[model samples]
Target: MKLSAIAAPHLFIPPEWDREINHIVIDSRDVKQGDLFIARVGRDNHGERFIETAIQAGASAVVALGEPGFRCGILGVPIFSTPDLLDHLSDWLHRAYAGVSQLDLTAVTGTNGKSSVTQYIAQLLTQMKIECGLLGTLGNGIWPNLAETRNTTADLSVVLRHLNDMAEQSIKYAALEVSSHGIDQRRIDGIHFKVAVLTNLTRDHLDYHGSMEAYFEAKRRLFVGGNIGAALINIDDGYGRRLAADKDITVPVFTYGHSDKAEVRYHNVELNARGMTATLTTPWGEADIVLPLIGEFNLANATAAIAVLAIQGFPFESLVAAASTLQSVAGRMEVYVKDNGPLAIVDFAHTPDALDNVLNALKPWNKAISLVFGCGGERDRTKRPIMAVIAQAHAAQVWLTDDNPRGENSDQIFSDVLAADGSDNFYCIHDRRKAIESALEKTDKDGIVVITGKGHEAYQEISGTRHAYSDAGVLIAQGYRKAGEDYVA
Candidate 1:
């Protein structure tokens, strides 16, 4: 596109330098030849400081967001000033990718279960011969054919491009995992969502959001403001209930849960070592589901996906049949068990509520449980000690291990997590691999070892570098079998 097309005024475009732009880049390091670098001011520093670096990196033009939100001027090297370029970035992105496909999208948002819910939707649809693309923490694509994404919700430009690619592949439906950060930053601003699903929200990401209200406000933006076609919520959650009843949500609201208030309620629920069996009563029809996934939270996640797909006009009987073949989401209640020893579960339960749910969900086994978990460094510090207390209360033994202790002292991280004046049940293991081994080695034949935080991740980061590591890999090396292969779990 031409410089005059975006800025309109001659003053906003440098004289004799209206060069053709190739790509719209925000980060200076990502700039390339003919790319238009956007200097957006952030919380720590302004992007104008990186303009020189961007230029050296072959950026064709630099358009910086005006300090007071709206202004226009000329700068060196085909540079220009625009009216809050960062704030209005989505507008330019929509224009740039105007021909991109707008698939029937369903954005699943919450602190936990975002990945599980989104993936379950994609998995179920794929099983029914529907081409559904996925965009979330797991990756982006159709089913198992996925590529890595930098974030759970990617940048607006990447999202548009990915959706367009999926559409080109003839995939008409999409499932998206929308995070609070993504919603707050307007990364998914131009998405035409068919339905917005809420699993539940709890204490997570308080560091960036500063408060629960602010965190919820970011999530609230996904459902309200006339952006989505319908709202599907889990009424069992306090926050979900608040959002369901919130006057700001102008769209039709559909509720799901075991609660009486839920429009799409599940009853006669049964849980066991194999999976969960439940009957779902929805506005469309009824479904008798038998999922191969463990955890009551998975029950909620599965139901949310089933309800949303039903709302999209899929047959209830086919969905009910598809439910029986549902596979466990990667790293989510993924089981690794010994021949006659303790059962080990690898999960991504970092938050207090998620940890609690995982522990509670494992209670049906009626075995002595050993837990190995740790909070990520430089994150919401308040949750660290809280997690310690929960671990001590739930498990017979607790191992506090390293979980991405980036640029933070390992000793300091453990001390914060082990905040108690007295810790009779805590064992500090700074090494992640050793922590998993120790936690498993000490457990009895009938016991269970639950590993939380950094699930499905292939590496462990300490200091600044990520070292290759996997909890499941460690267990398999120890002769523990995967869940489906004559497992003892």
Candidate 2:
């Protein structure tokens, strides 16, 4: 593509540099000849410092916020500066792709359940024989073939590149998990959403967002700002209810929950070892949906997904049937049990509400529940004490271990958790692997051990170092490979 074709008209492009370009990059290491390098502001340092490196790596041109520092010296490339760089980049991307808006896109955002809801939307669509691509923590691809990604929502350049790939593959639908940071940073500014979903909001990321209101406003940008065709919100959540009440949105809004006013509501739900079965009532039609998922929270996720599909014009009965066949998301309520071994569950429940929901959902096992959990360093400190309280209330045994204590003292993090609970059931285990072993050893053969904080995560961080580690991998290595009877599903 010509350089001028992708450049925003308002931004100045050197006449001599208006040549063909192959790609755009944010990281200097990924730059190549014919590539346009972008230096967006970051948390610690401005990307401007990497200009020389991008040049060395063969970046043809440079676009960044503000003027370059004197230390960067003179650049040989066409250097451009703009105070409104992000908005301009968004505009440029929209014009460059052109057909991105034509793809069926669903944007999901909330404190939790974003990954589950996004993946569910993709899976349900694929079951309907629709080619769908997913972008989130689990990875990006068409269903089972998804490749892993570092962030729930990738940066603008990566997202656009992936969207282009999906379009090339003829993917008709795409579901993405939109994070508060992503929205706040304008990572998703360019893309238009066909359906916007608000799973729920709770006390989380206050360390970064400062307050609940600011965090909510970040999420609210998706439903109102983007060219959204429709909105699906979980009214069971206070924040979701508030979002549904907003009449400023010109697009169609659909509410889902157990509330009397919900457009799609479920009643008389039966939850057991196998999963949950609920009688769903929707405006299009009604059906009893069977979800092979473990928690009441998952039932809520399914209801939210149903709303997305229903808005897409699928029959409620077929959505319900196809939903039953959907698989559980990795590391979210994943269960493993072996003959004559303890039952082990691996879940990515790091927040207060998420931890509470996962533990409460395991109530029907009728076995001693031993929980191994920890709080991440440099995160929401308020949730630490609250999680300690929840662990005490639900688990018969609690083991506190290091969960990515990056740049923070492991002992101090453990101390904060210890101060939260006065109970005698808690034990401090600094080693995560040892913590899992202790949880299993302290329980009876029929005992249930649940590992929280890090699920499907392959490493542990301590004092700015990441060591390879996994809760499920350690549990299975400890002779818990056989499927236990408790995992009926």
Candidate 3:
């Protein structure tokens, strides 16, 4: 693209230096010949400090959020300075990617269930013959096929690139998982969303957000002022109730849950080893639905998915029938068992609320519950003790293990978890692999073992590095079976 096409007035491109820019890069290390480097200040450091590095790496032009500390004009390269570039970045991106296919986009935000809800929507849409893509924790792409991403929500530029690709591929629908950090950092600033779904708000990311109110406010932005076309929320959540009570929401609101006040309410809910069956009641219509996933939380997630499709004009009956085929998202209450072997579940339940839900959901099983869980390092520490308490309250045995002890003492993390004073019921095992193996060895054939945190995650971060690891892989290597595989013991 030409410099004149996407340039803001703050960016003064000299007539002599005017040239086409090949790529737009934020990180200095990624700059290359013909690339436009954007020097924006981040939470901890200013990108301007890396201008020299980008220049040396063959950056065509340097775009700074404001005046740099050093001289740039003397280098004979065009330097454009704009104050608060992040505020207008999305607009610039929209203009740069003009004619890109604009899909019907839905954004899901919450501490828990965001992954399941977004993935379910993408799967539902695709099964209905609509070309749809999903962007979230598991990865990004159309239904079953996806490429992994570093974050639940990628940088605004990365997201745009994916949207551009989706457009080129003729995909008409996209479901995005929007996280509190992503919203607070303005990573999704420019994307226009047709529907905003809030699964539920719980105590999480408090270390980054500083407070629950701040965390709530960050999530609140997506449903109110920005580019929301509709708001689909789980009114059962306390924060969701607050969001729904807001009379200021200009977009249409669709509420779902077991509450009678909910527009999409479900009753007669039943959960088992196979899946869940529920009697769903919605504004459009009602039906008994069966989803091949476990837990009341899954029921809520499915209800939220149903609400999303209903708003998109899909028939209630079709959605009901489609409910039977809704596949389980990776790591979210996933169950596996081998013949005569203990049933093992792997989940991404890192937060206290999520852990409680998953454990409670397993209450119906006849087998004794053995819990394997741990908190991530450098995260919200307050939840560690709470999780330990919840584990003791629910499980017959709790195995506490290291979960990505990045830069923090694994010993200290375990100490905090053990502080809950459930020493009688819990064991401290610093090695995650040993922890899983120990849990499996101890649980009887009639029991069930649950492993939480780091579900679908391929690596464990420790000492500022990611080491390869997989919860499911470890189990499989130990003679445990995959979902559809029969156990030969």
Candidate 4:
């Protein structure tokens, strides 16, 4: 597309320069021939510093937040200045694709389980034969046709572009994971969500939000933003309950939980090595649902999914039948049990609440439990000690290991975690592989071993480098092959 064509309504560019621009890119590293580079102000570094690099790499033109001198430095590319480059980029893209609308968006936000819930909703929609798109931690794009992305939540400009792309592709629905940071930064400004689901809030992103109240408020923005047609929330969570009580929500609110008072309630809950089954009673009707995923938390997750689907007009019988087919979300309460050995679970329970929930759910299966987990470096340190207390309180044996420790001393992170519990039953291993091996070696045959923190992640980042690592891969290497294989080690 010509520069003038794409920038017509959003920019007052000279008509002659329309043919000069061909492609648009935000990152200077990705600049190509005929590309228009957008110089954004980043958290740590100014993107303008790379203007010379981008132009030299064959950028045709440059759009910057502020003035980029008289020209585009050495490459002499045309420079366009805007006070708010991000907003301008979004506006330009939206104008370029005027036919696309942002109406049918659905955002899910919380500390944990957001990705799983988002994925579940996407899967459910796909099973219903709806043309849907998903944008979350796993990546973003049309369901079953995802494109890998580094950011869990895309920037405002990229989000608008993706929404436009989805609309162009005839996508009827979009499930989005609204990160607290993204919410606070207005990354989801223009999009209007039809349904907003709040899973739960916990201490996970203190490094960004700084306080629990601030974090909760960030999540509240999605529902209170007045764009959503309905809100699906887990009333069992204090934050979710508080959000449900909000007087400003003009849309319908559907609450789900184990509590009888919830609009969508579940009772006669049964969880086992096979999975979970519960009697669900909603305002619409009552039905039994058997979920393949384990954990009471997962029951709540399933309930939330059902509640959202029901609010969206899906029949109760369909939900009950479909609930059993819901597969295990990768790394979230994933169970592997063998005929002759211990049961093993791998999860992404890095937060205190998540750890407590996972450990509590596994308590019924085995009295002897071993947990292997670690706190990430440069993250919310407040949860480190809290997680220690929760793990030590729940697991019979605890193996503390390095999780990520990005740029921070591994020993320091472990020390803080150890100090949280003040328990001698826990052993520290700086090497993650050794920790898993040690846990496997020490646990009894009937014991259950849980490897937590990094669930679906294929790599462990440390000191600015990501090394190939996966808990499941490690377990598989040590004789734990299939879902029911015994690990004799």
Candidate 5:
């Protein structure tokens, strides 16, 4: 495509100038010969400051929201300014890929379970023989061909580009995890969504949203605007219930939960050492589902997926079969076994509500429960105390430890967590690895150890650096194996 064509509505250039442009890049480090560098302003710093870096890397043109701090004219590169460069870039990218009309897009957002549910839906879609694309913490790409991304949700240009790329590869559908920050910043403005799923809302990202209400409002954007055909929500969540109550919703709404009032309700829900089984009562009919994934919370997640797929015109029997064949999402309720002793579950339950749900789901197992978790630094601190209380209330033993205390004192974070649980039943360990080891070492043959927070993540952020860390990796390294497998170490 020509440079003039790419920047059409925003800027005018001749088709001959197309040869002067190579590719579009937001990051200065990735800028190459004849590339158009997009200087987007971020929370920490402005991309304009890196203009020289991009120029030095062979960028022939620059697009920014405002004037570049440096003399771009001297570099002999064209500079373009738009009202909102990111939005313009997104629009431009969307136009570039106008051939992707048959794509079905499903976006799932909430304080937690976004990644897991997105993965679940993607897996089921793939099993149904539909070409699918997945975008979330595990990275964005066609199913089984994921690439690592810096953000849980990609930036506007990257997102559209990925979609276009998938379309070119003949992918029929895509499952995306929409974060509150992504929605609030309008990063998803230009894309059309076939179905939008709201897992639940809780106290999280207060540092960004400033309040719980604002956080919910940010998540509400996914369902309110654009081409969203159906809204799949969790009626058990307060914010979700309110969203369902809103009469202004143009799209059909589908509610899922244990509540009878929900459009897709569950009954006779059972969670045990093996897994979970629930009798799903939907608008179509009633059916029993046995999920390989543990926890009743996961049952809710599964039901949300089922409801969304059903509303999208998938057959109910196919949805149920696809769901029942679904396996556990990595890191969310992941079970690990040892040669002897208790069952260990590593989950991404960082929020208070998530913690409560996971613990409650494991209640009927008749085993001593040991919960190991912590709060992330530079995030919503309001939930730290609540999670501590929940863990203490539900678990036989609560282990409070570090969870990516980025740029915050580990001691201060630990202190705040301990403040929530005043009882002697809790133990504080500043080191996360040590905390997990301690939890496993202390567990008996009839115990259930749950390692929570930072699920599917491969690193731990501390201060300004990200260190290689994985809870599951550490557990496996410490002589832990599948339930019946022998640990060589």
Candidate 6:
């Protein structure tokens, strides 16, 4: 494709030269023969510094997102610049995927249920004999074949590239977890979503978003800005109701919740550590759905996924039947148990509400619960104390440790956590591994031990270093297998 043809429409200053290009590469190391290297403003340093390396790596041309009158020092290849490149990035980034993007995409946004809803949607689609690709905190790739990703939502360039790859691999459906940071950063601007889902909104990412309203506005972009075909809003949440009531959103909006007001309502719920069974009332017809997923919040997540599939024209009864077959998402109420061993769970419940939900959901287990949890350093300090209080409220014992301190003072993070709770049954063990081991050792064999904040995560980050670690790996290393791992040989 011609560079001019790819960029002219999106760029404020149209491309003057019509150089042929094969691919668009953001990283200099990824440049190959016939690839157009894009030097954009990165987090740390300007991408301009990598131009020479990209050129040497066989880049066909260079497009630099730089300041006005910015000069390209390298002379071997044609170089271009645009001061306002970020504004039009998604458009041109998507141009590379024009012929490849055939997947019907669903982008799910929320504070907590993004991963579960997206994963559930993918699982349900795959059960229907339809190939589905998923991109989120769990990883990025086709269902059950995902590779790990750094963020819940990938950068726009990576998003387009991954979508193109999924399309090439014959994946006709994709469900992506859209984070507030991703939306606020314009990482999802150009991808037109066939279905958009809201799981619910609560306190999270306040450090980055500054306020709840700003955080909400970031998520609000999904339904309002994108080429959204239909939106599934969880009217159960105040923010969801607010977003649904907004007059500016022009798309056909559908509501899903427990009440009759919801166009796709669900009721008659039975919950336990094993999973849930509920009757779903949808526009197509009513059907009972069962999911082997823990937490009452998962009911909402599953409902959102079911509503999305129903809106996409899948047979309602078939979807209801398939619901029971959907697998549990990693790190989201992920359970691990063996005969005579404790009922253990690993979940990514980093916020106050998430922790409360996970802990409270385990009440029907009919066993004493010991929780290992902590606040992430340098993130929404206000939630720290609240989480500590919530943890104590739900568990028989609370173990406090680090959750990705990331250069913040670990002592300070814990101090904030204990600011509210100055009582017994609260144990402070700074070492995460020790905290988990201690929590497990203290709980009886029949009791439940839950680890929160880092589910499915492979490493623990502290003071800028990430040590290789995993909550499930720690359990398995101690002779306990992953919740669903086969033991029959």
Best by lDDT: 3
Q: lDDT tens string, model 1, 403-482?
A: 88887888888888777645555888888889988988899978989999988988888888889999888898899878
In terms of TM-score, how similar is model 4 to the real structure? 0.92
Clash pairs, model 3 backbone? none
lDDT of 6 by residue, 321-392 (tens): 888887778788877776777778899999887888888888777789899988887789998888877877
What TM-score would each prediction reach against the true structure?
Answer: 0.91, 0.94, 0.94, 0.92, 0.93, 0.93
lDDT of 4 by residue, 1-489 (tens): 677777665566675444466456777876889888888888888788988899989988777787424353565577777676665676665565554474377788888778787777777777777877888777788987778777778776567667778887788778888889888877777666777888899888999988999999888888886467899988888998999999988888988888777888999998776677889988889988888776888888777776777777788787777777777677887766555666678998889999899899886575588999999999988788889889878888899899989999998897788776465668888899999888888888889899999988889999999999999988887777546312222
lDDT of each: 0.83, 0.83, 0.84, 0.79, 0.80, 0.83
Regions of model 2 farther than 4 Å from truth: 67-76, 482-489
lDDT of candidate model 3 versus the reference: 0.84
Of 3 and 5, the candidate ahead on lDDT is 3
Provide the lDDT at 109 for model 4.
85
Model 5 agreement with the true structure over 1-489: per-residue lDDT tens digits: 556777776765544334356567778887878877888788888887888888889988777777423233446776666666664677666666664556888989988778778777877888788867888888889877889988888777678778878887888888899999889877677778888988889888888989988988888778876558888889888999999887778888888898989989988977766677889999988899887767787788888887777788888888888887777777777778776757788888888888888888777777789989999988777778888888878888888888989999988877777676464567888889999889988989679899999888999999979999999998789777644212211
Q: How close is candidate 5 to the true structure, as a TM-score?
A: 0.93
Better of 3 and 6 by lDDT: 3
Residue 411 displacement (Å), model 5: 1.0
lDDT of prediction 2: 0.83
Tens digit per residue, CA lDDT, model 3, 293-380: 7789998998898788889888888878877888878888777776667889999999999999999988877669999998999999
